[model samples]
Target: MYIEVGQYLGQDGVWLKNDETRLFIQAFGGMTPEFSRKMRSQTRDYWLNAHWMPHFKAPFSGRMDNDDPEQRAYWQVELLRQAAGTFPCAPAFGPGTDNIPTHGDTANNVWSLASARLVDSGGESYAKAVWHLAGEFELLKYQKTDYLRQGDSSHYMVMTVENNHDDAVPINMAWHTTLGSPFVERGCWLLDNCQQYQVCPQGTEFDTTASLELGARFESLSDIPTRTGGKSDLSLMPGYNGHADFISGVSSSRQLLWSACYNPYYNLVYVSVIPLAQLEDQVSPSFMNYWIHSGGREMMPWADYDGGCDRNYALGLECAIGGSCKGYEWSRENPQLLNKPTYFELAGNSTASFVCINSFFSPEGYGRPITGESQLTEMIEQHIRSLDISFDGLQAR
Candidate 1:
């Protein structure tokens, strides 16, 4: 493997490539610009004054005057929030989650911070990155007004999290996993042990042909429905809903599981696997979520909505923890609903962990690796070990 340690949008980043594919890893891997410029032109958090992060901010849409400085600035905040809900940032093959540390109740530092280093030996290369709550930097854009006891937190385990649905409690850790927008398009498809499940509409205005249950036989991208809605659809609403009207659910077995997607556009297939054995695993997500985005709506926020994969669209296959991105409280409350562990903890950390792998299958793999799910599965089983991957510095035994 060949590695390039460089800067992405002024943030530290590493680029990796071999004969088959190329992938970018960042210190701030999952950070997205506060707003959308061109969906295709989005780099990993490199803008000068842009606030890129994975935040749970409110979403907004509709026409705004670009010429009006005040309106533009105000919309920028909303756009960033909307972008956070719509796009996944970077690919960090380690332990991280969405239950961010907050100053008080709801005040959170949207940007998840980390420092990543490249590890390479022989012909194999991987990333070794340490994740942390932002300490030295001013975490929030503004300060807390109320009496602060803990001051500002750099870790959620050190903070208090609460919801009306669940009790307010001292939280320790959560299961957090997500893959951003780069993994979608024509030949891009997710292979999982999915047999019938649920589909909950995340945003207020979401339109999907998806039934409450899905079959295991997904052979083509077109086999899936067009997730984008038209004029009133959230996908076309220009960052209006941060959650992006996503639909998700667990397997029929309803156990912690894994899923893999093939990205022909990138000449590789990405896998997101999760572990949900411990009750301390606060957040438990559905095995997968298919997030839809309209590149046309993103580019022209003021223009009319364009549904489907018109210009630039993304189909994200998410493997979430903490109740499918609901966070610690939700997972803790719903432990009885999840599958018990068939395997022991693989990492040394008390926090959530999993194995995420990506492999390059040449476009010319033809029927061998590209045609059938069994062929691809065997290929992954064979090559995944040679890659030498780890989630929390603990190698797979």
Candidate 2:
């Protein structure tokens, strides 16, 4: 395995690779350093007077006053756009009505790389990278380590948070794993062990044509009830529908929790897994949050009057401790949001850690939904065996 340090957008990040697969992990925000530098170097009045300012909708609209708090908050959050790949959302995770940015401060700030190395153990080679970041409140410390075995497609991650304050602090964390085109397109299917799902009403403003009723609960994603008295097939991705939606689900089976996105057209599948038995301190994720952004936001960056861009086409399969991406406060206030606890508290001067495994596979034929633990394991083993054969052929040549 090889580890390369670089920047994705403007945030510090790293890439892990072997013979068949390559994975990129970056700090939360998406803007390039140069872009961020330019924005920060300019005066606030410059952006206020700029044409782009008018494209922002309500709450941010008609607020020409430089002293307006809403306008200031909007500008601050805009700088944090473009967070890509797999990143951690900590302390607070999700979209809230509050002024905070989506996914909280951790997702908006840059993280520093602490170390990267390769280790050989038990006749296997593993590559690891450690990253560290401080909370905005400076009350907690966060560390995330990524591990990938040589010639393997699976990427393993462990994230830990330590409370520095003498008093316990509430924490909400999630692994925001995202996939974009050409890996994500129409006909891609989302398969999971989730037994029930609830529609989240937080980001409805991004799409005017959203049909799914807020707070609605359903069993299967293929036949979710919509406001139009119709059932939308969420199993497959929709084409240029100009609608965005958020849904949260829980797995009734406590053995292994997993979700997968399979693109039949490409015969490729991406799976995220968490073994319930391996979790400690009862910090197991309570739900899975799936976000479908199919060219829904017609705002600036996403769209402009002059040949706007298609800033959609991404799916987020997040394993979260919270019910939805809504902030901790909101989840606490509305305990009914989910039957399980929305957030967990980390004891003072103590630490809690979570583990997750994400794997990719390219089968020889059409791919199908991953339904159980044994199937997923066999698929991964098959992929590894194929890699070994290919490597042997190359050496023989």
Each model's TM-score, in the order given?
A: 0.49, 0.77
Clashes (N, CA, C under 3 Å) per candidate: 15, 4
Worst 10 residues of 1 by lDDT: 145-154
Candidate 2, residues 6-38: lDDT per residue as tens digits?
A: 654333567666665555566443111110000
lDDT of 1 by residue, 142-205 (tens): 1100010111100111111222222222232212223334434444455655543333323222
* Lowest lDDT block of 10, candidate 2: 45-54
Residue 236 of model 2: what lDDT? 81
Please state the error at residue 218 of candidate 1 in Å: 14
- How does each model score on lDDT? 0.33, 0.63
Could you tell me how far off, in angstroms, the CA of residue 48 lies in candidate 1 after the best superposition?
Answer: 25
